[model samples]
Target: MANQYDRNPFAEEEEVNPFANNNTGSVPAASNSRLSPLPPEPVGFDYGRTVDIPLDSDRSASQNLKKKEKELQAKEADLRRREQYVAFATYLGLVLCLFWNIIAITTAWIKGEGVTIWLLALIYFIAGVPGGYVLWYRPLYRAFRTDSALSFGWFFMFYMLHIAFCVFAAVAPPVVFKGKSLAGILPAVDVLSGNTLVGIFYFIGFGLFCLESVVSIWVIQQVYMYFRGSGKQNELRREAARGALRAAV
Candidate 1:
């Protein structure tokens, strides 16, 4: 019998392919035309490159400004101390002069020495120079230098008042005495007895001294307040900037 399935000579047993229909190939030799060496690796863009720029100038400027501020603060403190010391010294000097006047007046009264009284009055008049320098000139100088509210007008007005009072003291007795040593003695005694006119003069002088002292103390307080306020504000600003820098870091 002739078999239905026959090994055809042309087929030669249909040589089997191990990878038949698997879509597996030699990958077309990785065509140089299509691959093109990966486009030279894209030049390796870096996001963390450090840039060099000189910040020393800016840093130096900031440091210099801080130093200048510190220097100014130190100077202000020194000036305030000096002003207070001078004020205390002047107060002491004025008190001493007051004592000297009191002694001279008592001696003149007890001894009834007219020449001595006149000499004492002259000494009081001369004492005005030191008093005026302390109460008027020095204070005004400090006020101007410190840009204080204690104005030259305040000094001038008080100084004029002092001068007017002194003039009254000098002339009042002569006018009231009327060329009699006994009359001079009576007027002097009236002053010691607390006559209304003499009392008023004393009150005005005391008021002027009190006003000067008050103004000086007020100015010192104002300077201290300003410095403290500025320091607090600067500290707050510096702390805020530091917080921002820390966050970035």
Candidate 2:
């Protein structure tokens, strides 16, 4: 009873399997990834190394995409700069018009015939200079600084008012008497024979102002389009994701 498994020295051994080191094809492999020994190569088998197909097309496509990205960045920078300059120029033109109005008012005041013109110009200048500094110029500057259109509200309002202003200035016919802008609207009219010089100045201002209003409307629309476009949104999202990934790493 105690001699069990002790009498096999003289007995024949069991048959060995050729694939015992590996599992049978029908059976599942081990959980680990180490491979078992493979069979020897058959006679006349080529055993040639794998032919590597060069990815020249893919590399070229990537290079082209990178070049296009650089071009796009350059274009955006140029556009932002140009837009800022245009905005500044428009504001300068508006300020010049304000100055012109003040000069006209002063000339009328000197002639003692344009009390209305003088008072209105003075009031507008007093209110407008500070108001424009706060609402118009500051907002516009902030928008361009960050490449944003969030400040278009003030710009739109300003330009709309300017459009009406152009028409208002045009209709008030400067009937110059003794070198004055003796002009008025309904319920309050200043009737006087016009001097040729005042007529020329008023007409020129009217034309310039009308053209400026049209241009300002167009510029604000362009700014709105740039702000709402999906291109910038997607680009910003991608940049954010990249930043997050970098932080994680």
Candidate 3:
């Protein structure tokens, strides 16, 4: 019974140690001693240590300038071409009008047709209105400003004036022939008497056409000036481009 109790006593008490859970304590300390030293922190960057870039400031500037010059030259060339085209077209139109006038005069002379003359005079007046604005004023104004040439304000003003002139012309014949006969079934006497008023219209229209012609001459001179100026600008641009190219090289 004593032996059995002693055996049981030995089985009842198992040793409980809290320090057994910390088996790596001395091993961690010994391993830390064997570890390599940590790397040092990097100092602040040295900005001035960079290599010098071989940037040719003059060469780059010249290249950019040459590109700009070429663009300007191209634009000027296009403008010159457009100007030549416009000039040629204007001259062609003038020739056509001249031919038209000749034909109208010839027909009127051959037939002694007063109506033809009246019609021609009316056409002359219509043409002269625009011609006056275009030939006399527009070119000189464009020469100074260069921007007003494409503006429609002047054209619009001329159109309004033309309409007013037409209204006046329409009313004048009736006023002139107010008391005339209505005979010949087509207002013949009125139509015939209208010619008397139209005779005055012819004088006015002829004077305007002459003025317009003078203006056209002046406009042509302005166009010539533009051409000359454009040529000089082109030469200067070419020279500038050559200088830029040489500098780049």
CA lDDT of each candidate?
Answer: 0.52, 0.60, 0.46
Candidate 2: deviation at residue 210, Å?
2.0
Question: What TM-score, over all chains together, does every model reach?
Answer: 0.34, 0.57, 0.36
Question: Model 2 over residues 37-147: C-alpha lDDT tens digits?
Answer: 999976865578676767998899999999999999888778777766776666666666666666655654555545766777666566656765676667767866765
Winning model by TM-score: 2
* Candidate 2: regions farther than 4 A off: 1-56, 172-192, 230-249
Query: Quick one: best lDDT, which candidate?
Result: 2
Write model 3 residue lDDT over 1-249, tens digit each, in one string.
356544564466778886775677655554354667899988877876887656798789889999999999888667656654554444444444434443433333344444544454456546764674575345434443453432323433443443344334323343323311111112223333545433333333334334434444444454556645645445545666887999999
C-alpha displacement of 14 in model 3, angstroms?
37
TM-score comparison, 2 vs 3, better candidate: 2
Instruction: Give the range where candidate 3 is weakest over 10 consecutive residues by summed lDDT.
Output: 179-188
Instruction: Give, for candidate 1, the lowest lDDT window spanning 10 residues.
Output: 176-185
Residue 194 CA error for candidate 2 (Å)?
3.6
Rank by TM-score (best first): 2, 3, 1
Expressed as tens digits, the lDDT of each residue in 146-209 for candidate 1 is 5444444355455455545433443334552331121122344455454544433334444444
- Clashing residue pairs in all predictions, respectively, total 0, 0, 0
